[model samples]
Target chain A: MKYHGGHFICAVWKLDIRLWQLLIMASLLLAGVWFRDFSLYPAQIAFTFAAGLITQAIFLRLFKLEQHGFLSATITCFGLCLLLRSSALWVHPAVASLVMASKFLIRPQGAHLFNPANLGVVLGLSFFPETWVTSGQWGQDLTTALWLIAAGFFIARNAKRLDITAYFLLFYASLFLVIRVAWYGYTLPVFFHQFQNGALLLFAFFMISDPMTIPRHHKARILHAAVVAVLAYIWQYQLYWNQGIIWGLFWATFLVPLWNHLFPAPRYQWQALSGEHT
Target chain B: MTTRLIFLLLALSISQTSQAFCGFYVAKADASLYNQASQVVMTRKDDKTVLSLMNDYQGELKDFALVVPVPQVLTEGQIHIGDAKLFKHIDDFSAPRLVEYHDEDPCQPPVMYEKMMSAPMPTAAMPQKAKSDKSLGVTVEAEYTVGEYDIVILSAKESDGLEKWLQASGYKIPKGASAALKPYIKQNLKFFVAKVNLKEQNKTGLKFLRPLQFAFESPKFMLPIRLGMINAKGPQDLLVYILTEKGRVESSNYQTLKLPSNMDIPVYIKDNFADFYKALFETQVKKQNLRAVFTEYFWNMGWCDPCASEPLSYEELKQLGVFWLNQNSNAPQVMSGGGVPVQVTRLHVRYTPDSFPEDLSFQETRDTENFQGRYVLRHAWQGKPEQCEAAKTYFEQLAKRHEQEAKTLAELTGWELSDIKKKMNLNDAPDQESTDQWWKKIW
Candidate 1:
């Protein structure tokens, strides 16, 4: 194959990536409108579109992420959607927007910073005690569980962090068992409901799978994901009634950079012997 | 550094432990009109010292409970009344309860101190033989009930022999030997109980004895009289006077009368004296409009010299008389500056340490000089100015009287009259001029 001109490559790349970005945005808006509630459709749709474009622009500038990185952008957009929804549920819209804006200004390092949704909601709740964020609309039923598992698995596959995903699932399940035994008195249905509750499935898939912020090494990423899963499970089941996924995402993001620094990525050199078809 | 840290930790632990038990209560007592009944109860608790009052009545009650950790005996642990006291033991913890009355509105309950006013008088005869041999001297006995406790006061001459007796009898003479005796007597005094005569031997069940209620008179309304002692020892030179409203003898509405001589004494008071006095006065005023009459007796006679003597030169005495005349005389003379006719019944000079002795003597001499020189100088300087010009003419006549008397006394005492006149002439001459002229000079 002959090498293509730089402009031709750039135009094609932009067109393809923009199409994928638009698809991801539409899916997020539809999910917010349909699954969340018809009442919240307008606000959720508007906030998701604005937040997605703004966050993508911010991450592109801060991390120099390539235009073709549709998987990374889509994952981030989903995370932002969940954050806006959670913030709106837990705190006043104005306050949640203010908190989200604060995260952008304070730590602009994309997913490497504190998980925007979790930090914002926790801080908003702490600051405004009279407000409460709840997921009362999402019924704790089996249908919700299947929907979360499917979505989580799909996102996990797209991000190509299968080992990290598996580790998180095992860690969360084990933690749930321990918490159930210690505090709630063992019940299978309670455990299932706890796992399926509010944006947990969405967080597990989109938030936890941010490749740029997650460790590249398989073992390190698995361990980081496991820690995040355990923390999330404890916060949700043991602590009870909290933004557990937000905390989980924050811990995972925090640990990834530390793990990367400690265990540097393996370097691959170009092999001249490949010219001879060896 | 480690020692300091350990010490800090130790101090913190000690403070926390102490704070756990140190507490107090705010108590309120109410009594109804007609003195029919009363009720006393605490409102809130601080640590362990439950603030309570003593009253003789029956009613409903309300109070708050505060639990803490430190032992209640520490000095920092105080029940704040006007004068707070520390809780000596846990049993001292019971605060006064509201009295229960069946059918009457409760009156304001008597405060802890006022309860003393209602105590019955002690009988003239001694109830029991003196526990000590030296206790036979004059004893002043007083009894009063405060809250649920009875208080008595007994004053007897101090005797070493009594100390020995109490010691030999295994009685612990409490610390603060002299002060503790009053409470001891109050606690031990027994009341007489009447029994049914046993002439009818066939009385099946025991008949009851007549109940005896102690009779106590309310204290007279009195202001706190503070006597200041100047150059005397042992309260000898001190005289105290308490002035009060005419009809209310027991009411606290009276003021302390400050006599000219009282200014001589040095004033010293206990730390919470003001609070005690205020609480006392408030309680007395609530009962009735009150006043007090106080008289002082010197423990020693030597300090009475200044109080008894009258010292003034003849000319000085005349001037003193004239000064009083000036002060007592009405304005706008009755007869064209001829001096308004007035009777002088008494003229005397009063002195105390607070009074400047020098100023008194100077005033006396100035009045004696007849003010002749003053009038002459004023006339020469301004030719009869308005305002006080008529008074000046009257002062001139009084000065003439003083001059004659000063000379007479001077000759009789063999003193130089010139020296007396010279002193009298030293009074400051008045300056009278138009405001315009005065401003002209200033500018």
Candidate 2:
């Protein structure tokens, strides 16, 4: 198979990629239905599906996410779904849909100005005074942490950003240790829960590993990821303000281009010396 | 370089060691009581003496004496000795001597010694009685010193009391003798022992012609006796009964009394004196009774103002019908919106235009008018003509009641109706004509 833009389907029309992405998204939807034990009423199911699809379509179109291709659309949709699920605590489904729709207004370009998930959570919390609720469980519950970790590892490997991932983990661990010592005198159970919970695992693998947003050089990428992880860990566990991962990812994306310009690695040179005609 | 490093280390160690014991110190003295004409001797640990002589008493200590340990200097104003701070002036001294001391010296601390010395003296001899009789009490004489004054207490028997006392005595008790005798009697009386300023008087001898009976009286019995003396001139021979149990003067029935030459009688017993007595008596009675009162009322009538309305009942609240609904049921939900019932748990009401007998009615009308006006304005701005028309009908009835209440309040308070109109800022009365005109313009 021939490749365009490092993807086998990149040469295909943009609409075809979108259609393929939608099929994958539908399969995810079916998985949710199959996994959930409580049978949703047909009307409820229809409403839920329609709300998700309309919100996803409206925000994507408004933000011009199509220009970024199927990958961007898929990542944005996945992030939006996870955020909406989390925000279901305080707001009605329709209101959550409306909140998700507001992403287009806040987005600067085809990509989000802030992390869409973090912005959605903050906007929902502030705008709807009566019904701002939090989804207490991340993924499904504590049990899903292992699956998330495995998925993160798989994603990191495929992105060929192992050094960057390792650096991120190391930097995060150090920051966590420092803050834990300062706050609780040692690393606490709550600190581990904070690391496992929310968009942290997903963000490390998906957002930080974005090839277009991060630096291309291995060393630069390592530094970039490490900085992001440290900042994110500080914001979440140390500062105790929500949406640290989003801010970390946003800042790390900006820093990648700057790091590439400032710290370029020396070019490889091999010396060829001829023995004097022996 | 190594020598310099060693020197630096030595310097650091010296500084650190010296820093521990360095603290501020204060020296204090009371100059007023201290005789500046005499020399001051200060003893030190080395048995060496620092002397401040009479000539060293300049108005400011800084002018004459040297402040030792040059960096630490003495302040010139008033100095504190122990807890007491004495001024520089000589006459202000009440103590016999002044002591000087430093606060920081842990060993051989401060010391004080008396500046003046005196010996205790014996009492003066008492005069022997000339005669003794059974009717009067035993004759005795005593003398005591009070500061510089001498006082004597003398008692004579009845046989030597009247005529012999007149002959033997150089001074005769005044003719209507009760006046002169009153103070002497009061002094000797046992009832006055606790209350009088006997201990304060600097006296040596008390001479009594007769031993006055000392009977203790309660405060209740004494109060009236005190009041009688306060009212009357000179001293009256009054028959006073004292309440034995409660310490009060029961009565003072005054007879004819002679006036002293210097005394102003009427001005001394003014109306204020009577008022003071009456006030004291009334306060006592009120305290005995322990009477006080408090009352509160709560009521709910039909209609009221928005801000000052009674709480709505649960059934009444159900009419709004908004509920909190959780949208994402799958996630651990923290909040929700939709039809969640809210029940009114408390009620409070406040009324104004208080003088108007129909204050509740008046407030209701005013509140209704204001509410309707706001509603109409909002609907009109929203382009909801139907709602605005409905609100207009509600406003018409409100305007009538407001006018009636305004007229009633004006008449009751004797205020001009025009003043009421001005205060309300009404362009014209809220009659049918104005209402029709207002509607036409708005529509």
TM-score of chain A of 1: 0.65
List candidate 1 stretches off by more than 4 Å: A1-32, A35-41, A51-78, A83-111, A115-132, A179-184, A266-278, B1-443
Instruction: After the best TM-score superposition of candidate 1, give how far the Cα of residue A111 lies from its true spot, in angstroms.
Output: 7.9
lDDT against the true structure, per candidate, is: 0.33, 0.32
True contacts kept of each: 0.00, 0.00
The chain B TM-scores of all candidates, as shown, are 0.18, 0.17
TM-score of every candidate? 0.31, 0.29
Once model 1 is optimally superposed onto the true structure by TM-score, how far is the C-alpha of residue B195 displaced, in angstroms? Answer: 55
- The DockQ of each candidate is 0.00, 0.00
The Cα RMSD across the true interface for model 1 is 38.7
Encode model 1's per-residue lDDT on B211-264: one tens digit a residue. 111221111111111111122122111111111111101111111111111110
lDDT of 1 by residue, A191-236 (tens): 5545655355555654565444567688788788778877777665
lDDT of 2 by residue, A191-268 (tens): 453555424555565455544445657778777877788678766544534456666665565565466667764322
Per-prediction interface RMSD in Å: 38.7, 41.4
